[model samples]
Target chain A: MRRWLAAHWRAFSATLARFAGAPLTSLLNVTVIGTALALPLGFYLVLSNLQGLARDYSPQPQVSIFLNIDAQEADVREITQRLKSQPGIAGFRFVPRDQALKSLQSRTGLGDVIAGLGQNPLPDAFVVDAGRKATALESLRAEFARWPKVAEVHVDSDWARRLDSLLALGRYAVLMLASALALALVAITFNTIRLQILTQRDEIEVAKLIGATDGYIQRPFLYLGSLIGCTGGAVAWLMVWGALWVFNGQLRPLAELYGIPLTLAHLNGSDSMATLLFAGGLGWFGAWLSVRRHLHHYNPS
Target chain B: MTQIVLSGVHKRYPGGHEALANISLAINAGELVFVTGHSGAGKSTLLKLIAAIERPSTGSVIVNGQNIGTLRARGIPFLRRHLGLVFQDHKLLFDRSVIDNVLLPLDINGFDRREGTRRARAALDKVGLLHKEKAQPITLSGGEQQRLCIARAIVHRPAILLADEPTGNLDADYATEIGVLFRDFNQVGVTVVLATHDMQLAARLNPRLIEVRAGRLAA
Candidate 1:
């Protein structure tokens, strides 16, 4: 094992020199891979933060139920007590018709028309606030629908449903984009490794000729490919952070629109580790596939 | 007893072209042998079979007490370690220096770096190019590069040496020098097989000749 490691080190050092031997080509290949990886990473950052904002600023649901004008004061008190007792129901507001008419008259420039003919024409109404998710308001809507004195059930935050759908669609789009870019990244690395293999074909075949095991011959290239991939993944992570930094100013107002206090999330420790391992695994697999294909076709005999 | 034996070894490509036909021969240890024929004959094929680079389509080949015809993929590398081989083009890694080239076989055979380098340098000394150890193979003349390849082949001290027209790429002067170098190695008890159609070098070496014609041994 010691001897194998010694030989492997020499092999690795030799391959490193050879890889860095062509400086311009190596740089170009790595940059191409890094850029391919960055697109999805950047999009995912934006999409993830948007989803977070959607969750953080989600409004509390409120339902307004207009009561029958003929309903007595005792009925209103009974409804209030019932609304408070239900699970996930914070409370309700009861507005008498006289108070409602008075506000309307003052705001609509009809305040002094013989004091609105000495009678309030508006119906009494109540406001219901949901204590939890917007879905929790559905029971209130149903209760209002079943009420004999209620005219309508109006949920103020129902439009948030459309926003939820949009956020979900955005997530799917980002995932699709990320997957496509990852494929492009794999191809870029594979093609670069393929070209490198082509140039080293003679040496590789000669190695086989001289009794180098397939694994022994494959070790250095696997390291080379993984180094390139993990380096690209590191660059992708940097691009993700850089893009978020540049867009931090714009994101604040967007957060304000939803009354959310959302912050940008760069690749975390888990993501960085995942990226490094993914890049290394991707590179190793690509090179292994390439070498296997070549060895099958390569006839040193 | 014969150290290298082939009994009715036949190799046919999947496309149905026969590379060798019923080849049966015996070579004693320490004997210098020449596999000679026109182009397209089975000389190279025979060498490949013995090295386990390719298996026989039919029959068996036994070399150094092992049946090479049945050797699997993993066994191929092991088979190559017991023999040193050279090619018509010299097949040297041009990116490496002369000493790096010589140290390659020993490196594969699992020698320590110091010992591998020491043996590689000594092998270069044998080929009379100890001073050129640091020079890139491309920097050397065709003759010097071929000598470097020979040094690399013998560096691990394998008991058998296989050459497929080792001097074919060199000029007459270099070719003659290479021929003399092989003669000296043969004198030192390395079983040598020189596969060549260069009738003149064959006559000079005066080795036991095994001729092939159209994939069959021609007496």
Candidate 2:
């Protein structure tokens, strides 16, 4: 076991020496992998931050049921009681026609135009707080619109629902981009290891002739590939962090304009670790494939 | 007491060129045997067969009682670990120092670094290349490079030593020196099988000679 460990250490150290030997080529390969990985990671960060913004700014989705202008007080009372008994409705507030007119005047600054018309154009409404998904909110709106005294129902959380759909789309796009880039990363490692094997073909032949097992001969290349992948992953992580830092700096003024503390979160611990392990695993697989293919063709005799 | 045996071994390359044909031979443990032939006479092929570097086409090559013709790919390395091989090309790693070249076999066998280094020095000392241990192989003369290959082959102290034209590129003096080294190794109880086209070197060593002509053993 100790000898095995020592062999592995030697292989690892030899890989490190190769990297040190060709600093420029190794750096270029790692940079390419890092840039490829960063694209998907950057998209994910933006999507996640947008989702967080939506959650923080709009805690509960709301649907507004506007009654007809001719709605009687009894109809309003019935609608209020119905809302109170609704399962998904968290809460509701009744706005009389006069209160609706007053709020419209205060918010829109169209009170002079409204008063010149000599009538309150606002209708009594019930603003309902619903803690449900976009589909559920739409269903509730449709249900409320079918009521006798309801003129129209509007989901005030429509923007949030659109944002959610957009986020879902972004997540899918990130996944696709991640998958494609992961394959590219593997291909890069495969080609890199192939070239290394070719350059060291003489050494491999000699080693095999001198009783080096196939495992012993392949160990150094495997180490080289995994180290490249792991270093590239770290570079990708740093690039993402740097991008987020820049994005957060730009978002500061925009966030202050809306008066919400908006900062894009960095990748969590598990996510960072997953990125590194996944990259390393891809590198190892690529090296394995290249080595298996090339080494099989070697006839030391 | 037979350390190497070939029973009607034949080797044919992909181009249908038969290198060895229906040849059978045996070399006992601690015996020094020379395989002498002209170019293309299958001398190197015989050494490769004994070293398990090449599988016989239709016969068995038994080295240390193991049938090399039937040895699995994974088992070949273990068989080769008990054998030292010297190639005509002087396949020394040019990227490493002389000492590192010698240390490779021991490293492959998983010997401890300290002990491997000690044995590597001893092997270099045997080849009279210890003074150039830290020098790169590319810097060595033709004779020195061949000596370095010998040192690398013997560092692990393998039971059997197979040399395919060990002095093929050396001058008369260097050739004689290499022949003496093989004789000294054989005296210490290591089976030494050497292949060469140099009849003078073979005669000077005065060991058992097996001649090959047209891929068949010469009667």
Candidate 3:
């Protein structure tokens, strides 16, 4: 295994030298792959940061389940307990009508007017911090609608769900974009490798005639494809970072508007590894498929 | 013992062009054999079959101790190490220097750079082109280029040498020089098979001659 690794390293060194020797061409190749990879990565960031904001600001999007005006205090407490056991309410707290009216008056600065005319017209309520995920909260909303003691469930999380769906739509958009670009990616690699094979066809014929096995001849191209894909992955990482950096300087107002901080979605260790494997796998498979099909045509022997 | 054997070997293209049909031969070790025929007479195909480049559809080809007809695609490189192949063009790796080109087989054979370089120089010296080890293919004369190719092929001291029109593009003198090199290598127990259409040139070498006529062995 050590020896094979060493051999592959030497082969790769040779490949790198060749790749470096043609810098302009390889740079073009890398850039093409990078662009293909960056689109999905960029969209992923938009969704990731928004998801982060949604996660941190859970209280901002909670549903306020107001009880019937005559509902018992004990009944409200029972609902709070039941909500705790429910999956969609991440957590909740009860507020009696008087406290609710008091807090509302303070926030709206209508306390004096409310103090003169009102006997706590506001109903007893439960404030629910909905689940981090939008889909999970839907069931909870449905349950509230069916309850007899519930006067209304005012879902403040509506905007969040809307925003998340927009983000989810954005994710689907990225998926569709990635799927389309993935086809382009494969074609890009396939064409690049095909041209390379055509240019190297003479060498291939000699290798074949000299008793070099098809695998032996095919090995170097496999390495080349993997390297191309790996390089593209690195380029993609840089592109994602570069884009975030450029936009980072301009996002302070956006963050303020959203009332939360967002760390721009960057590729994590897992994502980076996945992208590397993904891009490289794309390139390697492309080259392998290309060579397997064309090596026979150049077999002069 | 027959060092190379083929019987009833045939290659039919999918479109039904019979590239080689019923090729049969036995070549002894230590013999310099010339496969002479017109173009498309199956000379290249026969050589290819022996090297395991193309699979023979109808019969067996045995080289050294193994039946090449039974060899897998992955087995060809290891099999190639036993044979040195030369083409009409020197087919040097343009990206590498002459010494580096010669060292390629050694590299593949798992030899270190220093030892490979030493063997490369010695092989170049044997071909009378040692001083030009640092030169690239594009810089060398036609004769010198082919000689360098010969050096690269023999650097590993392969058991057999396969030359496909080695002198096809050369002048008479360069052609004869390459023939002499093959003769010398054969004398040293390297089994030599020279594939060419130059019958007059084949006579000068006085080697065992196999005529390939329309893909059939006509020796």
Candidate 4:
């Protein structure tokens, strides 16, 4: 165990030494890789932070169940009791036509025009709320439309469906971007490692002559590639975080106007760790491929 | 105690060049032997076969009790660990310091770094280049570079040391100095096989001399 630790430690330090040896080339590779990674990551941050704001800002779709204009007080009491007893329905409230008209008169400039009609022609209604998710509210709206004496059912979840479609599209776009950029990361690291192997061909020849195993020959390159990837991941994460920090300041007044507590979601610890590990894994894979292909040409005989 | 034995070994390249043919020989442990032949006479190929760098097309090459013909890819490094191989061009890593070049084998074998440094310095001292330990190999003269190669090869203390024309490019004085170094190593119980076409240099050392002509041992 000690020997294994020692060998890997040596490889790691040697990797750092090699990276330090050519500072400009290493910096160029890392910066390019970091920029590629940050693009998709920025898209993901926007999508997640938008979802966070939507959770608080958008009210769930409510089905306004209008009864016949002659619905009695006894019928209203029975319907309210039935709605409260239903399992899927969260809650409902009774809204008399007169109360609805009065609220609309105060909210709009058409109060005198509305008062010109001496008789209240509007019907009594119940606003029913199910769970906030689109699918549930949609199904509840459908169920409520079939209720006895329900003269009309007004479903306002069309905007919610549109918003959901947009979110889905954004999600797929982010996924596609991430996939393409991940490949770019792998290719960039592969090319860099290949160049490194070419430069170190003489050293590899000497090491092989001295009985270095294939594993030993490959160790430092693997570490170097992974270190580059991990550092790039950190750089990308910081780029996204910095962009959010700056944007969040601009978004504050808008969020305040909407009366919704809103802030952009930065990557948490596990997310950051996963990103680093994923990038490092891709870098290691690239190194492995290049090393396997190129090392065959070097024969110590 | 035979350190190397060859029985009916044959090597034919992909382009139909026969590099070796039906060669058979043996060297005992702790012996200083020389394989002397002109260019393309198969001396280097013979040493490479012993080092398991190339496989024989026929028969066997047994080095230190392991058959080169049957050794797998993973077994090559383990086989090489017991042998020190020196190239005609020295093959020194110019990017590293003299001491780091010597430390290559020890590092590959996972020796503790401090211990590896000590052993590397000792090997450098043996080659009379201890003062140049911190210098880059490219800065050294040809003879010093060759000596550095020798130090690296023997840093791991292998049982057999194989040199393919160790003095090929050296002047008479430097060649003689390297020959004496081999003799010194042989006296200390490391089997040495120094392959060279320089018959005069081989003659000066007066080790057991074998000649190769057109891929077979000449009688």
For every candidate, C-alpha RMSD to the true structure in Å: 4.5, 2.2, 4.2, 1.9
**Residue B152, model 3, lDDT:** 79
Locate the minimum summed-lDDT window of 10 residues in model 1 chain A.
A290-299
Off by over 4 Å in 2: A114-119
Instruction: Give one digit per residue, the lDDT tens place, for model 3 in A45-155.
Output: 778887887767655557788889999867877786777677655677888888888889989999898888847788898888876665666677789867769988877
Give me the candidate number with maximum TM-score.
Answer: 4
Which lDDT value does model 2 have at B188? 97
Please, what are the lDDT tens digits per residue for candidate 2 over residues A30-70?
Answer: 99999989889888878887888788887588888999999
TM-score per candidate: 0.81, 0.93, 0.83, 0.95
lDDT leader:
2
Cα lDDT tens digits, model 4, A110-148, are 789888988777889999876766677767767777777
Better of 2 and 3 by lDDT: 2
Using Cα atoms, each model's DockQ against the true complex is 0.63, 0.81, 0.46, 0.76
lDDT of 1 at A81: 70
Off by over 4 Å in 3: A60-94, A115-120, A126-150, A253-265, B6-25, B34-49, B52-61, B67-76, B164-176, B195-219
Query: How far is B18's C-alpha from truth in model 2 (Å)?
Result: 2.2
Give the worst 10-residue stretch by lDDT in candidate 1 chain B: B69-78
Question: If you superpose only chain B onto the true chain B, what TM-score does each candidate give?
Answer: 0.96, 0.98, 0.96, 0.99
Q: Across residues B1-219, which tens digit of lDDT does each residue of candidate 3 receive? A: 789998888888679889887777789989899999999898888887877767788899999878887887667678888989887777787866888878877777777777788898899999998888888778888888888888878999999999889889888888888899999999999999999987768878999998888877775
For each of the candidates, give the backbone clash count: 0, 0, 1, 0
lDDT of each: 0.81, 0.90, 0.82, 0.88
- Worst 10-residue lDDT window, candidate 2 chain A: A130-139
